[model samples]
Target: MLDFTSIVMTIAPELWLALAGLVGVLLGAVFGDRFNSFSFKFGALSLFGAAALAAIHLSGGESFGGLVRTNTFVNFAKVISFVLAGVALFMSESFLKRHETIRYEYALLTIFASLGMGIILSAADLMTLYMGIETLSLSSYVMAAFHRDSARSSEAGLKYFVLGALASGMLLYGASLVYGFSGTTSFAGIAASDMSNGTLFGMVLMIVGMAFKISAAPMHVWTPDVYEGAPTSVVAFFASAPKMASTVMFANVLFVVFGAAYDQWQLIIAIIAGLSMIIGALGALVQTNIKRLLGYSSIANVGYGLVAVAAGQEAGAAALLTFITIYAVTSLGLFAGVLAMRRRGGMVESISELGGLARTKPVLAVMLSVLIFSIAGLPPFGGFFGKYEVLRAGLDAGLMPLAILVVIASVISLGYYLRLIKIMWFDEPTERFENTDAPVMGTVVLSAVVAGIVFMVFISELGTGGWATYAASGLLR
Candidate 1:
C-alpha cells in the first residue's frame, strides 16, 4: 500500500499551486467586477507564496515513490519561474484592466501553468513528463487567447493550439516508438535497456519532438507570430518559465534515458543549436514589434542553453542551469521595459514609439539599456558571463564549430538591441507620450529587472555554489 504521507510530500508543490489557483478562482469570482484593480496584485502574491513553499520543500526529501524528486535545482528553477510569473501578472494588470477584463480565469491559468512546470521538473518517467507538458500547454493556449476581444489575441490562440497539438502528437508518437524500442518509459528503465541492436530511428524522432517543444529552429515557425499577436505579458511568461521547464525535461530525456547514446544525441543537439542560433539572430533583424523580437531572441537563448547540453558533461550541465537562470532575469527585465513604453498615452508597440524615451523617462531608459545590453551578451553584466560559460563548456567538449556559430549569432543580434538603445537616448520624442499620470505596475516590474541584473553580477558566486552545483549534478548523473 502506498503511504499517503509520501504521496503528499511528492506532490506538495503541485498541490500548493493547485490550491492557490482554486482559491484565486473563488476569490476572484466572489470579488467579481469590484476588484479589477486588485486582481493582479492578488495573483502575484499567490504565485510568490507557492514559490516560497516550493523552496521550503527543496531542503526536505524526495517523494512520490521515487517517481518524482525535488532538490535544489528544481527548487531554484521553481523560484525563478514563480518570480517571472509574478512579474508577468504584475505587468499584465494595468494592461488587462485597460484593454480586457481582469478575470479570475487568468490567475487560475497561470497557477495551473506553474503547477505543470513544477511537475515536469520532478517527473522520473516519460509518461509523467508528457502529463506535465500537456497540462502546461493547455493552460498556455487559453492564456494566449485570454483577450478574446482582440482579433490578434484570438488568432494567436488558434495558431498556438494548432501548432502545439502537432508538437504534442509528435512527442507522443516518439514516446511510443521509444517504448517499443526499449519496452519501458521510465527514465531509469530506459537507461538500463540494451538498445545495441535496436533501430536508432525511434530515438532520433523522440529528440526531434523534444526539440520542437524547446523552439529549436526549423520547428520555431509559430513562435514569432504568436509572440506578436498575444499579449506582451503572456509572451514574457512564455519566454522564460515554460522554456526552462521544457528544456529541463528535454535534458532529462537525453541524460536519463539516452545517456549511453551520448555520441548520437550530442551531434543532434549541436545541429539544432546551430540552426536555432542562425534563425533566431537573423530573424530578429527585421522585427519591428518588441514582442516578435523577443520571440526570435528566445529561440537563440534556447540554442545557448542547448550548447551546454551538447557538451554531455557535468560542466555543461552546470552551464545550462546558470544560463537559464540569467536568461530568465534578463527576460523579465526586458518585458518590464516593454511595458514601460507609453503608447498614444497608453502602452507603446512599434520600435519607433520609443523615440526620446530616455529624455522623459531616464530611469526606465537606463533599466531598458541594462536589459538590452545583457541580452546582447555584453560584459560587466551577467549575459556576458552566461555566454562565456556556455562557450567554454562547448570548447571543453571539442565543439569548436558550434562555438563559432554562437559568436556569429550574437554579432547579428546586435542590430536590434542597439537600435533600441539609440532611439531611447538620441532621438527626440515624436509627441508628448504620457498615458497614466504615474507608472505604477511598470515601476514594480522594473524593480524585478534590476534584481535580475544585480543577480547576474554575482553569477560566478552562485553558479558554482550549493544549489546551482547540486542541481547540475542531478541532471548529469
Candidate 2:
C-alpha cells in the first residue's frame, strides 16, 4: 500500500506536464503566434521531462484508490510515447512556421495528448481508461484540423471527429455493460468476475471500439482520408505516439483485465489480425499518394502487432512491445522522409514524385530505402527481427495458420516496398527536393540509426528482448 505522498510522487510526471500545459495556454494567449518557437521547445522539453521522470520513478503500484496504476510495463509505455511526442513537437515547430500556421496552442494540445496517453497507460479502472481515451481523441481531432483554412485539413478533422465519436460511444456502451454485469468498474474486479454472456458481448464491443481507434481493419475506413488530408507533421506525430499508446492499451485491456477469458477473445483477435493484414497489404498497392500508402502500411503493421497479442502469455507481450518499438521508429523515419519532399516552397505528396531521388538526394534516398526495407521485414534490419519474434510467438502458441498468413502478408507487402526502392534507385530523378528542415533531417537520421542499431541489441541475449520480457512478466503477474 502506498502513502498519499508516495502516490502523488509516482504520478508527478503527469502532474508536471499538466501544469506545463496550463502555463503554455496562458503563454499562447498572452504572446500569441510570436511565442510559437519558444512554445514548441517548451512543450518538447516538458514531454522529455515527463519521460525522464517515468523512467526514474519506474515502480509498481495502484494510486487514486486503484484508479491509476504504475509499473515497469506502464512506465516503459509512458517513456517511449512521451519521447515520441516531444519529437513531434520539435518537428512541428519548423513545419508550422514554414506554413505560417504556427501556434502556441499546437504544442499545448500535444502536451495534453501526451498526458492522456500517460493516463491511459496508468489506468487501473474502466472510468479512467475512458477519460484518457476521450482526452486523447479531443486533442487529436483539433490538431488534425489545425490548418483551418485548407479544405483537406477541415475534412480530415471532420472525418476523424465523426468516426472517433462513434468509436467512443461503442466503448462507453461496452463499459456500461461491463459495469452492470461485473458490478464494478475496476479492471481487477472485472477480471475476477465470472465470464457471463453479457460481459463477453460487452468485451467484443469494446474491442470493436478499440480497433477503430487503432485503425485496425474493417474498422479502419477513416485512416487513409485522415492521413492524406492532415498536415504531414501532424500525420508523422499520429503515426508514432498515438499508435503506440493504443496498441499498449489493447494489450493491457486484453491480457491484464481479461486474461482468464483468453480462450474466448483469442479467436476474435486472430480473425481481426487476418483481416487487417489482408486489407493493409492490398490497400497500399494502389495508393498513389505516399501518405495514403503509409496509412495502409500502419494498418498492416497493427495486424503484425495483434498477431503477438493473439499469442497470449509472456512471449506475446514481449513480442508486441518489441514490434511496436521498431515500428514506431520506422514510421517516424518514413514520415520524416515525407516531410523532406518539397520543391519551390510547396509540399509534394504523390508517390511518383519520388522519381530519380537517388541522383538528386542520394543520402535521403538511401535512408528511405533502408526504412522501406525495414518495414517490408527484410533481413538484418530491426523490422525483420520484430516480425520474426511475433511470428515465432504465434507459432509457439499453436497459431500455425496465423503465422503462415504473417509470412504471406510480408511477401505481399514487398511489392510496394520494393516498388519505392526501385523508383528511388533506378527511375529518372524528379525535381530536386528543397533543403530539408533540420528537425526533419534529424528525425530521419536518428530514426534510421536506431532502426539500424536496435536489431543488434534486440537479438542479443541480455538486451532489448530481455527488458521487454521482464516488462511483460510484470503485466502478466
Candidate 3:
C-alpha cells in the first residue's frame, strides 16, 4: 500500500511547478500583453520555489508503491534543473522583449518543462520515465515554434516534433521488451531479473532513445537545425536544463538498474561517446552560425560527460556531476552573451558578425572569450577541472583509450573556439553591433564567469567533504 503522505512528499516540487504554470496560463488569458512584464519574475519565483522544495526532500525514499523514488541524487538534479530553468527565463526576458514576441506562454512552458524534468529525475518505472519525457518534449516543441511568424522557427518545431516522436516510440518499444523479458517496469524489479538477450537488446534501444534526447551524435541530426532556428533564449533553456535532466536520468537507469550488465553496456556507451566527440569537434570547425557551432559544442561536451558515466563507479559518478555543474554554468553564460548580441538589423547569428566586438563591447568580448576558453577545457577555469575530474575518473576505470580520444577532441575543438576569440579581438572593427542594454543577461554572464574561475575552491573543499561522492552513493543505493 502506498502512503498518501509519501506520495505527496515525492511530488511536492513538481506540484509547485505545475501550479505555477497553471497560474501563468491563467494570467496570460486574462491580462494578454499586460502579462509580459510580470512573466519573467513569476517564472523565476516558481522555479526557485520548486528548487527549494526539492532541496528540502534530499533525504528521499520510494513512493507510490516503488514507481517513483526520490533521493539525494534526484533532488540534486531537480534543483539544478529548476535553477537553470530560472536562469534561462531571466536570460530570455530581454531577447523576447527585443523580438516583440514576448508572451506569458514562454514562461509557462519553461516552468512546465522543469516540472517534467523533476518527474524524470524521480521516476523509478519505465512508464513514469516516458510520461516525463513526453511532457518535457511537448513543451519544448511548442516553445521552439513560439515565433510563429518566422519560417525557421516553424521548421525547427516541426523537425523536433517528428524526431522526438520517433525517439519516444523507440523508448516505448524498449520498455515493452524489458517488461516482457523481466515481467516488471520498476527499476528494482528490472535489476533483480536475470539478464537475457532480449533484456540487453531492450536496454540498447532505450539507450539509443536517450542518446537522441542528450543530442549525442548519430542521433544528433536535429540539434544544429533546432539550435539555429529556435529563438536564442529557448535554445539556451533547451541546451542546459533538459540535457542535465536527461543525462542524469541516463546515468541513473544504467548505474542503478543495469549494474549487473556493466560490461555489455559500457562498450556501447564508450562507442557513442567517441563518435560524439569526433563528430562534434570536426563538425563545428566549418560552422558559420554561432548557434550551430554551439550545438556541435554541446554534443562534444555530452561525450565528455559520458566518459565519466561509462566508468560506472563512484568516482565516475562524482565526476559526471561536477562536469555537468560546470557545463551548465558555462553554457548559460555563453548563451547569455549571445543574447546580448543584437544590432540595428536584429539578432546576429553569424560568427563574422562578432568581429571587432572587442572594439565596441570589450567587456562582452572578454566575458565571451573566458567562456569559450573554459568550454575548450583550458587551465585555471572550471571547465578544466571538470574535464580533469572526468578524465581522471576514466583513467582510474582503465579507460585510457577513451580518455586520450577525449583529449584529442578537446584539442580539435580549440581551433574553432580560438578562431572566434581571434575574430573578436584581432579582426578589424566592423559596424558596431547595436548597443542593446541587457543588464539581466550581462549579470548572468558575469556571474557565470566568476563562478567558473573560482570553482577550483569548491573542488579543493571536496577533499574533506565529498558531496559529489555522497550524491553518487545515493544513486547506487
The TM-score leader among the candidates is: 2
> What is the full ranking by TM-score, best candidate first?
2, 3, 1
lDDT of 3: 0.86
For model 2, residues 371-454, the per-residue Cα lDDT tens digits are 888889888888888898899889889999899989989999999999888888898866878888888888888887778666
Worst 10 residues of 3 by lDDT: 456-465
Report the lDDT tens digits of candidate 1 across residue range 1-477: 877776676567778788887877777778876655666677788778777777766643455555676655566677778777876776677666677667767777888898888888777777888888888999999999988888999999999899989888877887787788888777778788876545256677777777877888788988998888888778878887787777877776687678888887788889999999989989999988878888899999899889999988565877877788778777866776676666665668788888998888777777778778887898767788788888988999999999999899999989888988898899989876664323443643454455446656567565666446776665533
Q: Number of the top candidate by lDDT?
A: 2
> Where is model 2 poorest over a 10-residue stretch in terms of lDDT?
456-465
Root-mean-square deviation (CA) per prediction:
2.3, 1.4, 1.6
TM-score of each: 0.93, 0.98, 0.97
Assess candidate 1 and give its TM-score to the true structure: 0.93
Q: Rate the local accuracy (lDDT) of all candidates.
A: 0.78, 0.88, 0.86
Segments of candidate 3 deviating more than 4 angstroms: 1-3, 462-465
What are the per-residue Cα lDDT tens digits for candidate 3 across 280-391? 9999999999999999999999999999888986658888887887787788778778888877778878899888898998888888888888888998777888899889
Error of model 1, residue 392, in angstroms: 0.9
Backbone clashes in each candidate structure, one number apiece?
3, 1, 0
RMSD over all Cα atoms, model 1: 2.3
Which scores greater on TM-score, model 1 or model 3?
3
